[model samples]
Target: MKKTFKIPMSILMVFAIVFSALNLSVFAEEKESNDEYNFELVQKDDNIVIAKATHENGDELYATLDKATSEITLEAVEKPKGLLKFGDDKTTKYIVKAETIDPALDVVDVTIIDETTKSELRISPEYVQAQLPVLVPVVTWGGRALLLWLMEHALAMTIAGITAYVATDLISDIRKSNKNYWPAWIRNNNVYIGGDAFDTDYQAVGWVKTANSGEYNLWARTEAKAKEAANKAAGTNVWHQGKPTDGHYDHYHPAKPLVTDPWVVKLDNHLWY
Candidate 1:
C-alpha cells in the first residue's frame, strides 16, 4: 500500500500566519475585469472608442475616447485641464472586446460630455465602497497597487495601455460574468509596434506589466505562479510550468511605450539601493 504524506493542521496554520505577515502580493501587468468597474466599449475604429451607459437618473452617458497614448501630458503645465463631468453615482463600467488605444488622448482634451449635469454621477470613494463592494474582485498582480495607480493617474495613458495589454479573455469574461478565462498564447508578448515579433520597441502607452512580490524581480509574477499558489492552497498538483518534456515556461511581455511615472520610478528603485 502507498502512504500519503501529511502535515498536522496546526503546522499548516503556522505557515498561513507567516504568509500573512509577508503580505506578498504578486504584481502583474493585466488585471481581471469584474463587476466592480463594468463599462461598455466599442471599437469605432482600430483606435477610436465609444463608451455608453444609461445613467442612474436614466439619462445617459456617452464618452468618446480619443486615444490613450503615453505622450498624454497636461496641455499646459501652467494651467489645469478641464474635467469631464459625472454626477453622484456609482456603478461598474460595462466591458468586453476592447478596442486598441491610440497613443494621443490628452488629459485636458474633451471627448465625452453631458448636455446636462444630472446624468452620470461620481460618488465618494467611501460611499461607493459602502454601496458597491467587490464581493469577488478579479484583480491582477499587485491588485491594490493597480487600483492605487488608477486612482492617482486616472487620466494617464498607462491606464489605457493596461486596458490594452491585459488578457483579452479576462476583459471578455467580465461581460459574460464568467469565472473561467483564457488568453492567446502567441500574441501576448511585448507590444508589437511598427514590426513583427521583435523583443524591442515599445507601444505608445509605454507601461508594461511589472511585478512586486517582494522577490526582487522588479516585475510582476506569472500566471503560472498564480496557479501554483492556487494548487498549494488546494493541496493539488494543478500548476504546470511548460511541460516536463520542455525546459522553459511559456510567458512573454507586451507592447507599449516606456513610462517613468512616479510608481514606475519607484519600481525602478528596486534596481538601485
Candidate 2:
C-alpha cells in the first residue's frame, strides 16, 4: 500500500496571507523619474553637436555644443520642473553657459548636481542616448506581484505540479525518437588510430584523419582499433567501430602531420569512428 500526504487548508491560508502582505509591502508605492539629468550625443550638424535627454514627463531635453567656442547650452520646448545644476554645491549653477567642452568617444561629458544629494555626478553621452529611453511601466510590476500572490495559493500549486509532471513525460516522449551522434564534419574528415599507438616521438597517438581522402591509406594498428581496415579502404574517415581512450592518448594534437590531413590527437581525446 502507498501513502499520500495532504496539506491542511489552515496552513495554506497562512501562506497566502504572508505572501500577499510581502508583495504589498514591496510594490504598493508608485515611482517617478527625478529631474536629475543625463545627456547623450545624437548627431553633429557641422560645428554644432546636438544632444538629447529625457524629461520626467517623457519629453526631449535638447542641449547643443559649439565646436569652435566649446560653449554648451541646454534648450527645451518646455522649461524643466526642477532647475538643472552642474555641481555638488547648491550655488554652482549652469543656466545658459558652460566653462569648457570635454569630449570623449564622440560623446560630450557633463556634470550635474543631484537635487537630493547636492553632489556632483557626471552623465556620459552613451547613457543619455542608449539607456535613458527604456521606461518600466508601473502596471507590469503590479501584474507581476498579483501573479506571485496567486502562485502561493493551494489551487494554483496543485495545477503547477500537474503541469510540471505532464511536461516531463512529454519531453521524455520527444527524446525517444531522437538519436545522438557525432557531427558529420568530424566523422567525414578525420581518421582514427589507437591501441597503444605512438607517433615518431613515442607520443601516444589517438585518432588520425586524412585531410584529403584517397591520397594515402590511413592505418589503424589493431582490428579492435575503432573501425575495420576494410572501412579505411573505402576512402571515408569514419568507421562502424567506436573510439578508444586507452593509454596516454594525445590530448592536444600539436604534432606536425606527415600528410596534408592534420591527422593527430585533438582536444577531448575521444575519436568517432
TM-score of 1: 0.23
How many steric overlaps does candidate 2 have? 4
Q: Model 2, 200: alpha-carbon shift in Å?
A: 73
* lDDT tens per residue, model 2, 147-221: 222212111111101111112112233234222111111121233221111333112121134332222122322
For residues 1-273, write the lDDT of model 1, one tens digit per residue: 999999998888777666554413234223323322333433344344454332222323334434333121111001111131224433223121112222222121111112233222212222232232232122111122222223122222222123322222123333343222221111222221111111221221122222322111111133543333232222222222243123223322221223453311122111100
- For each candidate, C-alpha RMSD in Å? 25.4, 26.8
lDDT of 1 at 55: 21
lDDT of model number 2: 0.30
The 10 consecutive residues of candidate 1 with the worst lDDT sum are: 72-81
